[model samples]
Target: MSEENKQIAQELIDAVGGLENISSVAHCATRLRIMVKDKEKIDQNRAEDIDKVKGAYYNAGQYQVIFGTGTVNRIYEQFIALGAPESTKSEQKEETKKQGNKFQQIIRTFGDIFVPIIPVLVATGLFMGLRGLVTQEEILALFGTSPDALSDNFMLYTQVLTDTAFAFLPALVAWSAFRVFGGSPVIGIVLGLMLVNPELPNAYAVGEGEADPLMFLGFIPVVGYQGSVLPAFIAGFLGAKLEKWLRQRVAESLDLILTPFLTLLIMITGALLVIGPIFSAVEAAIMAGTTFVLQLPFGLSGLLVGGLHQVIVITGVHHIFNLFEIQLLADDGMNPFNALITAGIAAQGGAALAVALKTRSKKLKALAFPSSISAFLGITEPAIFGVNLRYIKPFAMALIGGAAGGFFAALFNLEASGMAITVIPGSLLYVYDFVPLMLYVITNVIALGTAFVLTWMFGFSDKMLEEVKTE
Candidate 1:
């Protein structure tokens, strides 16, 4: 740790109370989550008073301190230096261990891992989804006559910005996972790109067949690492741990030479042999589980669809589900679950739109409007956090409303024939398959209308709604 960082960390620890008072310390994307045995053991107000500290919150049995951007490592080192005992000293472990059930743990872990990245994920994902909307028809029209239309510059830029992420999702996840695990995000990104490189054909399975190949250590096969979660996460987690350990152990004299070499050796080997397979298995398990749930009685499916849809959005793993929708659409030429999620996304938007129209705060309104539009396009965090979560009531109302929509869609067995950006008229691509097209349209329209009415009724108050237009 830098002397300056060490100083800051030490001072903050001292201010909070000696390391002995700290029951546990952990971190998420941008904050130091600390738990002290006693509320009075250390001065909470004093910790918050520090210049480097952004803010603090005591909730769900955790004391969270927001810190400077990218300061987690420094803070972590300082906590260690303060001679705080490891997990053995933690008082809350018993309570934390009892957190409901496996489903809840999965939900909690998913939230812990992905919530911090939602803003960026949604921004980039939305932009890509929108870009597709802008270029799809033109590309299709051009392709209708000439195959070369896709080669145009306008199409190329859009393709690069939007399709590139899917094409290189493994790399994006690697970086995001690295950030999550306290590693150099740049290194994680480079490692991710290597996994997906087309020239490295054998390196990973390119969506389609490729001629050239890249071998890992000249042997183990690297497969689709893009947009994958488990492999990158496993690799990045090991890499970060290795890096931290090496940086601490290597002598200053030979550190430069030994550190990078050992780190790379550990990461590459660990990723190729372990992380990759683990993630693949996880992917398989999830698909199996979802398939099982979908096959259940319609009410059960509706419940899972409604509840898990939001959970999926929260975890940023909905893209994997979206991929399933796309494949199902292509194979069966229709997908009912997709309709369920569409309703869920619409519910998010309805709730946010309600809050936007009812909130008195100008800043909140400004924040809510764009988010609501984004949710309409199928990105929901800005709506979820900025609006729905704040009002609290709206999210639950939306969820129940979403369940109602899902029940109706499932009862009708409405399926989208193809996936399209939600904002585009092209989202109507599968509407023709609707039995009694008018009923299908009305059903979907009612889904959104019901959500809106529910949110308005459940979320709006005379005072809040009246204060809304003040600005």
Candidate 2:
């Protein structure tokens, strides 16, 4: 790590209640996720004031310090080198499970298990969008070929790039879930593979009536878990707990061989006989509910999702939406949720920019401007925690802006071909259609302009700027 990272690491440790107070430390895509023994001892304001620290927030029993993407990993290494105990995703999940009520714990567990796997999904989403772009009628015509005339090899390559992740989504979900539940990730993967084995008919095929589900134990019907979320996650959790229980009871000499064998034997049976069918039904119901909600009349769905999406982000439960968006893409080939989320994110940036423009203090402007840019680029912690949310009125104005934007998005029926990535980069996801692309641009503009105008009029005051300057 660089000297700057080392210094930032030390300041972060001190800011989060020092090394003694920190029980475990980890990093996600853009935050230093720390589990501390004494949350009250830490000064959140002081922590946010650190030069490299963009913002800080406590969610699901973890204090996450936003340091952006690349910088966070460096600071994480430095923090570990400085004697902060390194924590895995599983340890973090365990800590979270100890802190909350049953409902909160379930939500937190979902976030912990899914967050580490988002990058892979994001990459696959981008590829899906890119594949759509390259295979577009115009793009193909430019290459002297139509969709029907495209070569089988080219189509095969595109399928490999775009379909593999969703096709084996259960495996990815299971791997992450098992890791979060403190089990061997490879075993988790193998269990996931078993759920989607080629020997069994594909899940989608069974749903489409192209194949039949095999009968298990003469009663329960078993099918492949490909592209399924809840089933894989539940299986991984149960498998990990079972594996741990076996490890404790089994003899040490034969532990390695017998433990895995027994774990797999029991888990496979449980998954097929019980977990798979039940949770798959639950997942289907949830997806159906989500679809129904998103399809509500007069753009009410977008208004609700857009206005409150960032609030979910504040609690760090926003990661659950990744499953929703991915499922939407797999089933419908378009993600309208991403369109709504983009509006919310763009509103944050707009409010931040409004704050930057209204403030006379250079220090305040310095924080607001870059934070606004980061929000526009699909990251909003800096804008939300560092600027808008700090000023309650600005945050409220942003919510209204988001609601407006989302309303228009639903009215326009805006959609994206991808799950993650929004605002400027998200444009790539809609390149196959001109109208959706145009609506996406207009939706963001509505979010930005509405928030900017609203915040400028009602969200700020000279007194507030002066107080911010003094701080």
The best candidate in terms of lDDT: 2
What is the lDDT of every predicted structure here? 0.60, 0.86
lDDT of 1 at 42: 63
Q: Give a tens-digit lDDT track for model 1, residues 1-471.
A: 477767767776776677776777777655676766665666654564454554455544556665534776677667777675544313354455444456655544444444444444334444544554444555456557433444688777765654554556556666766675667777777777766655544422344465433356676545645555556656766776777788899999988789767877777667766677566677668756756766677656755685458756654345445445533432243455766776677777777777678767565566567767777766666567555654567777677667776677666666553453342232554433225234445545555667678878776554653343342
lDDT of 2 at 299: 95
Root-mean-square deviation of every model:
11.2, 3.6
On the 0 to 100 scale, the lDDT of residue 162 in model 2 is 78
Candidate 1 segments exceeding 4 Å error: 1-155, 202-221, 291-303, 307-398, 408-444, 451-471
Name the runs in model 2 displaced over 4 angstroms: 1-53, 58-97, 100-102, 466-471
Q: What is the model-wide C-alpha lDDT for candidate 2?
A: 0.86
Kindly list the per-residue Cα lDDT of model 2 for residues 1-471, writing each as its tens digit: 498889888988888879999999998888889999989988876787777677788876889888777988999999999999998976786677888677777777777787777777777777777777777888889888888987899889988887888788888888898898889999999999998999887988998999999986788888887788888889999999999999999999999899999999999999988998888888889999999989988999889988899988876668778779868876766788998999999999999999999988676787889899999999888899888887778999999999999999988788887778898888888775667889999999998899999999999875875465466
